[model samples]
Target: MTDQQSKLLKGKQILVTGGAGFIGSNLCEVLLNQHVKVVCLDNFSTGKRINIEPFLQNQNFKLVEGDIRHLEDCKKACLNIDYVLHEAALGSVPRSINDPITTNDVNVSGFLNMLVAARDAGVKRFVYAASSSTYGDHEALPKVEDTIGKPLSPYAITKYVNELYADIFHTTYNFDTIGLRYFNVFGKRQDPNGAYAAVIPKFVQQFIDHESPIINGDGSYSRDFTYIANVVQMNINALTTENKDALNTVYNVAYGDRTTLLELATLLKTYLSEFDASIKTIEIKHRENRVGDIPHSLASIEKAKRLLDYNPQYNISAGLKEAVVWYWEHLK
Candidate 1:
């Protein structure tokens, strides 16, 4: 953070809903490092307590055990909060296909609840966790903010609804907001055990165990595969930017590059081999493509660069090497 940006957020009270999740907890850590007061609200549904356990002892960090689906919980968390980094959402296409009702309830309805609460509480800025899935079926190489295709899954629908609600909130109530459509974010603390776990970490773990990690398709599908640090930087930029034009719009938050699944798997195997030579020999398996999945995803981060002065520091290889090291240390 620059001196000017640090001064902008020095002592401000910020609310991070879903602060116990992967991206949220990382945000909380950064804010606390800057001596900002952070209020974390989570129901421990998808969020793990261990994620935010270290922050429990910080004098400036407050944890509110609550759900965003409930209006009262949203309102309470917004009180005296200068900014809201809304990262709470039910993610994953397959999970949404299996149980879309709960996904809608938590993502769409819960997002509305957060917006209402933040607007009513007079929060300055409401920055949220949007998704690259919103660009579903667009068939575009690098996705721009304005152009989007039909949602491919319940999860995508909920995320698109979030963008709609945010725009409406800004137009109707004059609420200042920014939505970050994140690409395949991964890093330390990203859970690798679940059925819906992200590809990078899951593959890393499987390689460590010398197990064949199944590729959903023929491994040709690619992704932007953003790092958690890059994501955290974008959120901080959205929260602290003084540019008036930067508000009330969405931006694609990504590394501005793409990596194929086979390339990604090969990279993982190579990185993991430094720790365990056997991992390099582990065969990679393939299966039929899953439903609601797009063949490729890339993002144009120029809007963010021009508006928020965003500059991502880590690319795929640099970020993956670091993530692999973390998993080796902790999950080994």
Candidate 2:
């Protein structure tokens, strides 16, 4: 956090709706470090208790164990809150494919509940977790904010709906909001055990266990894999920026580069090999690409850079090195 950011966030009350999940917990940790009072609202469905365990002891942190699907819970969490970093949603495409109704309930309806709650409470700003998936089927490189294609899956639909609701909130209720369409984010404390675990952490844990990590396709598919710290920076900027032009819109929060699955698995193997040399011998397997997956995703972070002064510090290699080290120490 910059000196200005510290000063801006200091003593302010922020509510993180998914504060026990990977990205939300990271945001909570950063805000708490800046001496900001943080209220975390999560039902523990997809979020883990252990993720927010460290913050339980922090005087500046408070956990509100509640579901966002319920309007009452959203209202309760938003009480006296200055800003809302809404990260709660069912994230996986496969999970949504299996159960679109539940995904809609949480991602769409829950998101609307948060927006209404924030607007009613007169929260200063609402910064939310959008997805690069919203650029669905556009076949565009370096995705920009204005142009978006049809949603490819139920999960994508829910996320795009979030952006729609945010825009409506801004126009109809005069509520200020910013949506961050995050690329593939990874970092410390991210869960690697679940069935819907992210690629990097899952592969890292597999390598640590001397198991072959499976690539969904021939490994040519790529993503603008972003680091969590970059995302946190974007959220903080969105929350603290005084520029009126920066509000009531969305930004692609990314590291502005792409990496292939093969390259990513190779990088993980190389990094993890430092901790366990045997990991170098672990073969990477392959299968048909899953449904609702785009072939490639790269982000043009120029909008966030111009609007929010966003400058991501970690590229793929640097972030993978750091993530591998953490997984080695913890998951191993």
Candidate 3:
């Protein structure tokens, strides 16, 4: 943890919704290490209990098994919490496309419940897991905060609605909130087992198994593939920033760099080959790009830097090296 983060969150009580999930579990681990009290709320729908099982015994870490779709559950999790890290949401465009209603119930309604609960509980700050999917059809090189095009998928719509609702909460109820628009975040504990799993972990697992990893497109599609640690840093920064200009706004949480699918695959293959030389022979296949897929994504993280004093420590290569080691040790 950074000195600033330690100073701000040392003794505070924090509530991490979806704490059994990838990003949430990472946050809980960091907070516990910082000697802060952490309350974790998870439904385990997409989150695995194993991700948080190690922290269950930590006295500073408390787990509350519940769904975010319920108001009572949101209220129960918010009780006596100093801050809220709202990361519980049904992610993936394909998943949302398949079942928009369920996605809406979890991402939209659940988010509203969290906001209302946080308002009533008088939490100091509410930082949430917003998405780069909110960028939608905007054909820009580097996405900025204020500029956004129409949402292409139900998932994108739900995340955009979150930003709208968050702004309203601050204006109407004077609640403090920060939205961190994340790019393609990946790292340890990120589940690669599901159909809706992100590319990095999924591809890494396939390579480790010496199976052909399929690329959705011609492998030209690119993204600002952020490291999980950088994301954790952004969340901590959002929660702790004392700058008045930083409050009640959103910031792009990313490494401010992009990598193509082909490049990513090659990198993963190269990294994994160190563990098993056979992985170097793994073939990569290409297929049609899925519906609602964007061709390229990059983030201009200037807003985060200016407002929150954000400094991302890992670029793609550095983060990928660490992630590869974790996946090898755990998944292999």
**How well is each residue in 134-177 modelled by candidate 1, as lDDT tens digits?**
99889978999999998999999999999999999989999999
- Per-residue lDDT tens digits for candidate 2, residues 1-332, read 89998998877899999999999999999998888999999999989999999889998889999999999999999999999999999999989999999999999999999998998998989999999999999997889899999989999999998999999888888899999999999999888987888999999989988899999999999999998989999999999998899999999999999999999999999999988888889999999999999999999999999989999999999888887778888998
Reference-based lDDT, each prediction: 0.94, 0.93, 0.94
Could you tell me the TM-score of candidate 2?
0.99
What is candidate 3's CA lDDT for residue 233?
Answer: 87
Where model 2 places Cα greater than 4 Å from the true spot, the runs are none
**lDDT at position 194, candidate 1:** 85
TM-score of each: 0.99, 0.99, 0.99
Compose the digit string of candidate 3's lDDT tens values, residues 1-332. Answer: 77877888878899999999999999999888888999999999989999998888899998888988899999999999999999999999999999999999999999999999999998999999999999999998799999999999999999999999999999999999999999999999998888899899999989988899999989999999999999998998888888888999888999998999999999999999999999999889999999999899999999999998889999999999999999999887
What are the per-model numbers of colliding residue pairs? 0, 0, 0
Q: Cα lDDT for residue 91, model 2?
A: 96
